[model samples]
Target chain A: MKDYIQKMQTGGDIVSAITAFVEESKKINEDNHYFTVITEAQAIEQAKNIQKQALTKKFPLAGLPFTVKDGICVQGVETTASSAILKGYKPVFNATAVQRMIDAGAIFIGKTVQDEFGFGALGITQGKGFQAPKHPDDPELCCGGSSSGGGGFTKKIPGAHASLGESTGGSIEAPAAFCGVVGLCPTYSRVSRYGLLDYGTSLDKIGPLTKTLPEAATILQVIAGHDKKDETSSQEPVPDYAASLGNIKGLRIAKIKEAFAEGVDESIKNSVHEKLTELEKQGATVREVSLPSLKEGIATYFTIALSEASTNLAKYCGMRYGQSGSMNTSFDEYFTKIRTHHMGEEAKRRVLIGTFARMAGYRDAFYNKALKVRTKIIQEYKQAFKACDVLSSPTMPILPPKQTEAHNLTPLQHLMCDVLTVGPNLAGLPHVSVPAGKAGIMFIADHFKEEELFRTHAE
Target chain B: MITQDVLDKVAKNARLTLTKEEAAQFLPQLDEVLTHFSTLQDVDTEGVEPSFLPVKLSTEMREDLPEECLTQEEALKNAQSKNGYIKGPKSV
Candidate 1:
């Protein structure tokens, strides 16, 4: 991140930096890491424009090139969310976050691939002229997803600083961990979701996947603010997130016991424990804290996410937007056929799970109970915060699965991958996944407390 | 386990169509996903409020005022349309 920004400041040619970076990206992308790359000519043109502006004044992110996840809407560009239903659908406007990045002088290289409709965690659902992004470190390993491309490109290509990734249950952090980059999923309404294609309305958050903590903070500074377009966006004051990186002296850090519970790999647990111990050596008070409800967070997260997804995705029926079906048939038949044919297996499964969970007789048992558990989870976080300033956990329980292993896993097994990261997301706490060892440690802070996350992450 | 009839009803409600083979494959998978959720029943959430969001949210309404929106051409840009209208299946 600092590397790209330093180039322009040291009198280097912005166009040359971007052109070389795009070429490098293309070389790696040939291995199928990107869903789409802005044509070399288009990227060069945008770089030339930024060069002209550079002659006059400097912006915080001047000439930084980033990729938009396919789920994010970019005006006149294909934003497919890796789903065939919206394959050719080019949004007429940029998503609020995308527009903000452009306003900060960041160039949009192109959209990155992801799980179709952000459905799967392993990012195995690759379609629409692209395959799943290969893990940068190991091609044979899975790219933890649904923000797979953002994590892949940021780590694989230098001079390409950061990419925006939306998280619903660990999408941002999982990929960041697997790809060995840093990702911050701000408290649920910290960044506006005005332009992201809805996955789960309540759970979705737009964030940045970058190589360093400060870069994530810098990008967050640019994009985090209340937008009238997104009613869920907080009216809370936007702080200088990058400016608040203080030493981790005298901060209360809680190591979540459940985060290292049964299924987690021993190495992943040790790495996070080592980081917490190091913070303790640096004058931070570290203690073990348990959120019993953590055991139920994954299940509750899926229930609420899928239930909202089922209703949120109902708008994709062929009667309006998305892939058109047999128009000569009755509307019901047309809608059904388009979904059946164009939507992928994960999308179908979630829609069904969500539909049944919200059904009359079953609503009380599944959806309602899930919501109640969600409350308990939130309360648990609130209670834990009373005892500690920030909580620590492994960003992922295991290393990126082998590509073959990821493909062979069942749905339940796939969800188990999110066990560590989902709890903070469910509670709307601001968390940063920072590289520690093979995997990463997540610093989870109370709601709207992004500053503490950065301060702790710096240590 | 989820019965075939329940699976069919879910597909219909979701505006999706499924083949017999697809249904046969999904029933067991769906059953597995739901079985995972059975743990939620063990938690005593007796008097808790259903949490739709992690933070408190209040509905913020905007005044109905005219503003620039997608032009008709842009509105129908991604859909199959005729005469500037988005076309759909026959109502009959």
Candidate 2:
């Protein structure tokens, strides 16, 4: 990313660069099916304006181009979150983060495909009619999701590009690990969620996926902060994220003991441990810490996320945006028809389960209990952070699985793929997944302390 | 405990129609996931407060000031409208 910026500073023609990029992306996007919509004309126009004014060095983002996950609204662009129900719907306003990116002069390239409504851990559950993005390393294997397409595109594209990815549970991290990119998911509400299609209202966060940690930090500097547009947006002051990009000499790393336990592949553990030792040579300390509530992460996460999702999704009836069906039937029946026809299998599954969980008789036992359990988990993490600067673990339990392997998994198996990631996500902590050896080693920092994630280096 | 009847009722409450095959296919799987969720019952959360959001956030109230907002055209762009208002199924 810095190299690309240097080129622009050295009088590289922004228009020419952006035009060539769009043409290159167009050729590659045809075969990969990662991009849902490439905003070539808009991007080139911005590039032309930037170059005409000779303003490359003036804007922090300069000529850098970034992709947005399908969920985040880019004004006048279809923001479906890859769900068929919202295929033709374009928002009137850019999401706060996207607006920030544009204001900082980052070129908007395209939208990438994702799991329907950010519902799946594996990329396979793209809303019916959308193709799931594959791992950049191999076409046959599935990229992790629900920021699946952005992860692959960020990894595959060369020279100074990033993707703005949103995460409910482990959407960004999982895909970053699988696609071998740096995915930095900020603490909940650290960035505004305004204009982002809601999944789990409280759990969703917007972050950047890039090839390098510094690039991720730079994007965070551009997007992270309070925005009145998102009521849930934090009132906390934004820190100098770029300033924190160096020197983890005294950093303390806490290895989540359970993360290395059974169900995790042995090679992943060794690789993550190896990365930890390498970080130690930079004078960082490592220690094992027990987070017992980690065992409850997956169940607790799905319970809360989907329950919120069901309510959030209720707004997508035939009367509003997205899909509309025959109005001849009663209102309820009409809505049922539109949703039944448009929502994918996973979407139906999540909504039904969410509805059942939030039902009167079961709400107390499932939804309420999950919330309390979440509190306990948060406390558990707080206790762990007391002894260490950040938590360490393999970003995914297993390496990126083949499309066939991902296809064969039952719903339960697919949900469990988020085992290592859901812990921090459920806690709403800031975390980043950096590819290390055979697996991605994820470093998680406490809520609103995203700068700490930058202090640790990848090299 | 999510029986076929419960699943149907849940689907109805959510305003989502599931074909008989979908219901048959989904019910057992939903039951399986819920069964796993049932394990949470064993966690001792005797008096723990629920964390609705992980961060402790206070209610933020904005002054009710009207500013330039989405124009009617923009607001109704995605809606199916008869005149200007969003169109809905017959209510009469």
Candidate 3:
């Protein structure tokens, strides 16, 4: 594995690597790891081009093969957000991140499955009755997601070096933890979101899910930078992420008390605790810290994410975009019929609830209040950072539950699974979930501190 | 509780449609989610500003120089058109 990654980074012997990637990607697709796998012709064409470039120039991510989540558009590819509504929407342009990866000489093998419009915490709850990607650790377990297929494929496919995933709350981290892979959720706008289908504009971010922290950092180095097309992207300078991978002598790590609150499985907590103990033994100080507002992060995140989604998705009403509706009595009737028939129950529930929260009477009570609480969450994180270098938590509160059990959970119970992750997401902090056992440990840092986040947990 | 009446009003506001049976099924589930969101009432966010972005943000603009863009044919490629115009409901 070490030799393979080293050769990939240096653009050495790429023909065999590309062949292996295509073969392994096809094998993994048998288990439903991909929504659309790139054709062998496309893979070979890209590989031959990169091999020719290896004679003189060396790109940072040369020869690396990666998978993209379905929500991020790939040019000429069937880029649906795993929704029946976008049934045949092939993008005309590449997402800025995808284009950057291609320019860096990385090969894309396929796009992975996700929850429709990224609304569900459980990976199995897609609109078209698509099965969830099986967990790499235990085939019977649920691959926790919105980024479910990205996490699953990266964990199981040896040929693919990384995966491109998008997250609103815990979409990337949850599946990463469940599949026992490394997932990084960069600071908001750290990577451009110009081509990503919006889940929640204020909360959405594009990130990488990889098998190791170093590989995640390498992918980040290639993908993270401001783009002229994305107005919200930060002007902050991108750091040399790979340079920050060594020596932690006296860093303060804050283990969040709220992560161990009731309902978290004991074994999950013990696994994260063991990792923290090991860090402590390696000259790092571990202290218990409390962010009381973190307890309400789930509710606040949903209020904001759902409201934004209702507006962002309003453009897909079977008009010029998305699959066209046949019932054409009137424009309103056409839209109503199309959305009612094509949209899933989860999507309808979210749109209705979001419209309710944005209603005249309820707007102040729900949407406005959630925004204020979100402010408090950000402030709490800022205050926490004043004392600690990074905040630590179990990426998910429990291990990967069986798909049958996950299917039986109530809507609120499913949302509660993301309690540990939504705080960082709501605050737009840099967070990475590193595999610890069957689950993972998450480290969060202040905005634009991704190097610090990777440095503390690269072990 | 999210009653059928409430669902109807919300569906109308969102330009979406749902059957009576579907509305009935989602009423209680949506009500439970709203009830959970009620926990935000406990925080005394009296003077706090609403957070649209966690960090201070300002949009960076590019020069408005004309560049290559999609042609008329390419722009209309995804549409369901009757002739050269996009097909839609009859207007007055």
Q: Which candidate is the best by lDDT?
A: 2
Candidate 2 per-residue lDDT over residues A134-157, each given as its tens digit: 678899988889999999999888
Model 2's chain B TM-score?
0.88
All models, DockQ values?
Answer: 0.76, 0.80, 0.65
Best by DockQ: 2
Q: Can you give the lDDT of residue A245 in candidate 3?
A: 73
Residue-by-residue lDDT tens digits, candidate 3, A1-459: 346645755656788888877887787778665454466777778888988886577666777787899999887777778888887777778899999999988887788898888987768777775567788767788888899999888888765488999989999999899888988999998999989999899999999999888888888898899887889998899999977774456878999998987888998888898888888887789999999988889989999888899999887877665688564477777777778778887788888888888888888888999999999999889999999888999999888889899888878888888888899999999999998866689999889989887767536
TM-score, first chain, each model: 0.97, 0.98, 0.97
Q: By DockQ, highest first, what's the ranking? A: 2, 1, 3
- What docking grade does candidate 2 earn? medium
TM-score of each: 0.97, 0.98, 0.96
Model 1 regions lying over 4 Å from their true place: A6-11
Candidate 1, residue B32: the lDDT equals 96
* DockQ-superior candidate, 1 or 3: 1
Give the chain B TM-score for each candidate: 0.81, 0.88, 0.79
The Cα RMSD in angstroms, rounded to one decimal, for candidate 2 relative to the true structure is 1.2
> What order do candidates take by TM-score, descending?
2, 1, 3
lDDT of 3 by residue, B1-92 (tens): 56777788899888887777887777888999998887788789999999987778776567889989767666566667767766765433
Q: Provide chain B's TM-score, model 3.
A: 0.79
